[model samples]
Target chain A: MRLARVIGTVVATRKEESLIGFKLLVIEEMDPREERPTNNRLVAVDTLGAGEGDVVLWVQGGAARVISEEHRKAPLDVAIVGIIDAVDIADE
Target chain B: MRLARVIGTVVATRKEESLIGFKLLVIEEMDPREERPTNNRLVAVDTLGAGEGDVVLWVQGGAARVISEEHRKAPLDVAIVGIIDAVDIADE
Candidate 1:
């Protein structure tokens, strides 16, 4: 899982059939080493109901599809699986 | 497919069982909108015969694992699929 902060929401009236009842959000990748957001922004399905400004743990690729069986057959590549409560890293 | 430039090769003597005979490479994402390499540097399994400095197309997720039956059950997240011959874009 990677860290990111939800930046905004995507409002698509029509999208892939598998994404029928999901929330698409804009998220900026969090570089924990640098402790900031990187330029790798992406759209992800919100499965945990994360709100804007919330730091989250996201999964990409095949695991993303596994989150929802319907998604497993879809072309989705990213998904928000958890809302982060905290992050602890050792500099050593 | 996404565009990226192979920066170099990775020398890992020991790795996952599925990647036994594959070459691991370092690639920097090519942000065509900015017309430069972004800070998204990643390590990917090379399926094609791509050399350093070569611009290539990479795939992420389950599609990555589909390249090889051995990789189908592995935890691999990325793979280099093609070495680009050229790219064309028009400014609107």
Candidate 2:
């Protein structure tokens, strides 16, 4: 998983049926140490009740479908799995 | 999903039971245009018969579980979903 900051939310009225109750958030990748925003941005399903400005841990691909029990068959490509508490990288 | 190159394979004798028949490969993230490797490396389950030196499209998180019918309950965090055939980025 990687660290990302939730920047905004996506409001889609007509989407896949399985994704009905999920909250979609726009996230920007962040540098591990400095927490600076990277150029990559993606819309991710928020499974952990994360909101804008929260640092989250996201998972991408098919695994995103299994994060929530209700959306087991959702056609989702990205999902926020956890809200990051802290990160400590040991110097090499 | 993101593009990555299969660099090496991982072998473990004792691991999660659900991952027994799956092949684990070490993948290096690549730039979309240049295909140059970035500073990330991950061990991902190969579901689409990808081999070393192949460029693949990989997905991470819980969504990876539903890629194959057999390993749906496996404790996998990353998986290669497709062997990339081509990537064409339209000029702005």
Candidate 3:
């Protein structure tokens, strides 16, 4: 998983039949150090009720595509894995 | 899979038993457009014999950890999935 901030939303008129009702959120990649935004952006599926400007943990690839055994073949590439409540990076 | 250029290699003296003999590559993430280098960096296992400076495709999460049925429980989070031969971004 990686840190990202939900910036906006995506509306696709046509998509995979399996992904019809999934809400897509636009997310800007965040630097792991301080959660500062990066130049890169990605669209992620939201099933956790994450709203705009929410900080989230997103996963990519096979993990994102397979939300369940039945959805294993979904074409999704990114998913909002979790919403960040707090972060505690220990000093080394 | 995502595009990444292997920038360096990782040498871990002590690691998980499953990852002991694996070669680890340090990769800098790339932007989807023209494969421009991004600020993000990741350490990925190289089972495909990817070398430094090689442009490769990588996968994250379960796709990475489960190289095979035997290594399904490996703690790895990234893997070099393929070496990119070419990219063809069509004009829209």
Candidate 4:
């Protein structure tokens, strides 16, 4: 898992039926030392009760499907599993 | 694929052997309208030559595994496939 900030949300009115209840967020990749935002971003499903501006953890692929028992049958790539209150990196 | 901003880099002293030569970046999910920074973040592999502060697009799961031929054998869930020079959403 890597550190990132939620930049936006995605609303897919027409999508797989399984994704009806899940929320999708847009995320961007960042550098830790400088904390500068980069160009890499993705759409992830939110399982945790994370709102905009709340730092959270996201998982993908098989791991992502395992986040929620419901997702086991959903066709999802990214999923938010936890909200991060604080992060303590070992060092700069 | 989703939009994200790169926040930082990741250094894994020990990891899957197939991920040796790839560059990993930390990313945060974002919103397109308000563009506020949310809490959902993740680590993604960069295939494109994207740097800090550049918005990019990321793919995951089966799609991520297909980004690079090498990744077919690697254990990666997230990957940066392209740099987002611009994005035009339909409307607010």
**What are the TM-scores, per candidate, against the unseen true structure?**
0.52, 0.56, 0.54, 0.52
Model 2, position B3: C-alpha lDDT score:
66
Tens digits of per-residue lDDT, candidate 1, B1-92, equal 78888776544333333345766666778976665887776656786888778889998767777876766754456788898887887887
Q: How many backbone clashes does candidate 4 have?
A: 46
User: What tens-digit string does per-residue lDDT give for candidate 3 at B3-78?
Assistant: 8887765343433344456666667788778679887776677888887678899987787866775335444567
What is the alpha-carbon lDDT for the whole of candidate 3?
Answer: 0.70
Please give the ranking of all candidate structures by DockQ, highest first, separated by commas. Answer: 4, 2, 3, 1
Interface RMSD of each: 10.2, 9.2, 10.0, 7.5
State which candidate has the highest TM-score. 2
True contacts kept of each: 0.09, 0.12, 0.07, 0.16
Question: Model 3, B52: alpha-carbon shift in Å?
Answer: 27
Q: Estimate, for each residue in A21-59, the C-alpha lDDT of model 2 and write its tens digit.
A: 876666778888887878676667776788777889987
Instruction: Report the candidate with higher TM-score, 1 versus 4.
Output: 4
lDDT of 4 by residue, B8-34 (tens): 665653444456788777776667655
What are the runs in model 1 whose C-alpha is more than 4 Å off? B1-92
Name the runs in model 4 displaced over 4 angstroms: A1-92
* Residues A40-74, model 1: lDDT tens digits: 89999885678899877565777566544566777
Give each prediction's DockQ, rounded to 2 decimals: 0.07, 0.08, 0.07, 0.09
